[model samples]
Target chain A: MKWLRKDLEKYVQAKEYVDTVIIPVQMFQVVDENQLEKDSFDSEVLAIFANEIEKELSGRVMLAPAYTYVKGADLGREAERLNEWIKHLKQQPFKHIFVLTLDMQWKKSEASLDANLLWLPGLKPTNLQSQEAVQVIRGQIEQISELIRSYW
Target chain B: MAAGLLAPMIRFAIDPVLQSQEKSGDLVNVNLSVDDITDTPQRVDWEVQQVDGWYESNINRTAWVYKDENGEIVALSPICTHLGCFVSWEGSEDYPNEFYCPCHDGRYYKDGTNVPGTPPLRPLDVYEHAVENGMLYLGEPKPREGA
Candidate 1:
C-alpha cells in the first residue's frame, strides 16, 4: 500500500496482510548545479521504482516515506541514522524491509545496514517518457519484484 | 469565534461530496484507434487529473481493452482482484489467450471472468466505455459478478 492517508486507513484494518515495507533512500546536494541535476534525476528514478514495486506488491507491502539525507554526508553516520528508521518501522511487524537506492556508496556499507539494500546502477539522464525507457523500467520492475517475492 | 468553529465543522461534513464530484464517474478519452483493438486484449494507458487532499497530480491508469466476439468494445481493469497487481494479456505462454497476473499466477478468461480455482476470486472489473467519433472514452471500472 502507498503511504497515503486512505491507504493507511486500510492498512490499519488489514495490518496483518502487509508484511513488507520499502524505504527509498535519496541523497541530494544543491550546492553544485551539475551534481544537483544528477542527484535529482537519480532520486526521481528511485522513487519511480519504489512506486512501481509498491503497486506490484500492494497486497503485501507498504511504501514508507522516502529517507532523504544530504549528499556527501559521512556514510557511517548516515547508515546509523537510517537504521533508526528501520528499527521503528519494524515495530509495525513488517517482516521484510527493502532499502532501495541508486547511490552505489551504500553498497560499501551494506553489511552494516539493518535492512535489505537494493542498489541499482546509476542511469544516464534520459527521457523517461520514451517507449524504450518505459519498457526498460517495466522489465526491471518485473525482475526486482520477483526477486523480492523470493524472500517470501 | 462562533463562525470559525462552525465553518470548520461544515466544511468537514461537505468535503467528501466535493471530493467525489471531482474524482469519480468522469470519462477520459484514451486516444486509441478503435480499429486497432482486435480480439486480443491490448493494454491502453491514459492519465487523469486527481485531487488527493491538498495534492493534485495526473495519475496514470491502465486497462486491457479489446473487442468481444460480437465486435462490442470491452475494457477491463488490469488490476488483479486478489491483490491489485496489474494483469497482462497472455503473459504466460502456457496460458494462451488469458489475462495472467505474474505476481501470483492469477488468470482471467477472455471475457474478464476469473478462471475458477485461480488466485482471483472475483472477475475483473469492467470499465464504463463509449465510442464517440471513433475515439474511445472510458470511465471508472465497476465490479461485476463472477460465474
Candidate 2:
C-alpha cells in the first residue's frame, strides 16, 4: 500500500496483514550542479523502483514516505536519524523493513542502520518509457521482490 | 403557449448532446488494431479522464488483451483479485501460458480463470469490449461469477 490517505485507512483496518515496510532513501544537493543532476536522476529511479515494488507486494508491504536527505550530510548522523525512524516504525511491529536506495554513501553506514539496506548500482539516466529501460527495470524489480520474499 | 413549444425544442436539441457525451466516455479506444492482437495476451496501456470530486486528471490503466480459442478478442484486467497486485503473462519461469502474480505466486489460466487453491479467490475481471472499424475499444471490467 502507498502512503496515500485512502491506502493508510485500509492499512489501519488490516495492519496485521501488512507485515513489511519499504522506505525509499533519496538524496539531493544544490551546491554542485553536476552532482545535483545525478542525484535528481537517481532519486527518480529510486522512486520508480519503490513504486513498482510496492505495487507487486501491496498486500504485504506498506510503502512509507520517502526518507530524503541532502547530499554531503554527515552519513553517521543521517544513519542515526534513519534508525530513529525505523525504531518508531518498529513499534507498529512491522516484521520486515527494507530501505531501498541507489546512493552508495548509505553502504558506509549499512552496519549502523536498523533495517535491511538495499543499495543497488546506479542506473544510467534514460527515458523510462523505452522498452529496453522498462525491461531492465522489470528484471531488477523481479530480483528484488524475490530477495524480499526470501525473508519470508 | 410559446413556453410549451420552446421547452420541447430545447429538450430535443440538448438530449442528443448529453447522450453523445455519455457514450464518448463509455469506451476507451486502446489504439491497437484487432488483427494485431494474437493468441497471446498483450499488455495494453491507455489513458482516461477521471474526475475525483473537484479534481480531474488523466489516469493510466492497463489490461491484458488476447484472442481466445474461438478467435474472439478478450480483455482482462491485470489486477490480481487476491491482493490487487498486477499480474503478468508467463511471468514465472515455471508457469508458462498463465498469468502469474509475483506477490504471492498467484496463478490464473489463459482464460482468466484462477487456478484452484491459488491465492486468487476469483477469476480475473473481464473488460467490456467492442470492435469498431477493426479497432478495439474497451470499457470497465466486470467481475466474473464462476469458472
Candidate 3:
C-alpha cells in the first residue's frame, strides 16, 4: 500500500494483514556530473518498480521511505544502522522486510543484513519519454515484481 | 480622503452579491472522449484541478463509466455503500461484471444497484455528467436509494 492517509488509517486498524514493508535503498551522488546522470536514472527506475509492485500487492505491502545515504559510505556501518531501524520497525510486526536497491556495495553485507535484499544492476541512461524505453522499463519491473511476490 | 471613503462603500456594496454567488456543483473536465467508454464498465482515475479563489488544489477521483444495455451512458461511484471502501469490478465465472466490495463482501450489479441480500445499504452513487465538445465532464456524485 502507498504511504498515503487512507492506507495508513486502514493499516493501523487492520494491522494483521499489512505485514510487509519495502524499504528502498538509494545512493546519493550529486557532485560528479558523470555519475549524477546515472544516479538520477537509477532513482527513477527504483521508484517506478516500487510503485508498480506496491500496486500489485496493495492490501498487504507498505512502501517505506527510501533509506538514502551518500555513496561510498561504510556498507557495514550502514547495514547495522538499517538493521537497527528495521528492528525498531518490527514493533509494527512487519512479517517481511525487503530491501530494494540498485547499489552493488550491499553484496558485502548481504549475509549479515537482517532483510531480504533485491539488488539490481544500474540502468543505462535513456530517454524516459520514448515508448520503447517505457516498455523496456515496465518489462524489467514486471519480472522483478514477480520475484518479490514469490517471497510473499 | 473622499476617494478612500467611496472605495470602501463600493466594496461593501458588492461584497454581499459576491458572497451570495459562491459556486456549487462544479463540473470537472474529465479529459475522456465519448468513444473511450465501452460496454465494459471501465474505472478511470482522474485528477480534478479545483480553483478556490487564490487556492488551487488537485484531487484524485475514481469513476466507472459504461454503456448500458439500452445504449445509455452510466457512471457510478467507486465508494462501497457498506463502509466507504473502494469496490472492485470482478467478472468471475459465477458472477459476470459484478462490483465487489472487499471490505464486507458486498456485491453490486453493473447498473449500480445493490443486490437485495447484500451488505450495501444503498445503491452506488452516480456522478452528474455531461458530454461537451466530445469530452466527458463529470460533476458531483449524488447518492441514491436502492431500487
Best by lDDT: 2
Report interface Cα RMSD per prediction.
Answer: 2.4, 1.9, 6.3
Clashing pairs in 2: none
Runs in model 3 with CA error above 4 Å?
A1-9, A48-58, A104-111, A119-152, B1-31, B43-47, B50-64, B76-88, B91-96, B99-128, B139-147
For residues B1-147, could you state the per-residue lDDT of candidate 3 as single tens digits?
999989867866865323222332366667788888899888766767778778897656789898898877787998877656566677234566798764345789998899789777799998877766777777777899876
Minimum summed lDDT over a 10-residue window in model 1 chain A is located at A9-18
Tell me the lDDT of candidate 1. 0.86
The 10 consecutive residues of candidate 3 chain A with the worst lDDT sum are A51-60
Clashing pairs in 3: A1-A61
Supply the TM-score for candidate 1: 0.79
lDDT of 1 by residue, A37-82 (tens): 7889998899889998888788778899999888889999999999
lDDT of 1 by residue, B5-112 (tens): 998678769753343334445778899889888988888988899898888988888899999999988999989887677787997788998998875678999899
| Highest DockQ against the true fold, candidate | 2
A118: Cα error in model 2, Å: 1.8
Deviating ranges (above 4 Å) for candidate 1:
A130-133, B1-26, B91-97, B102-105, B116-119
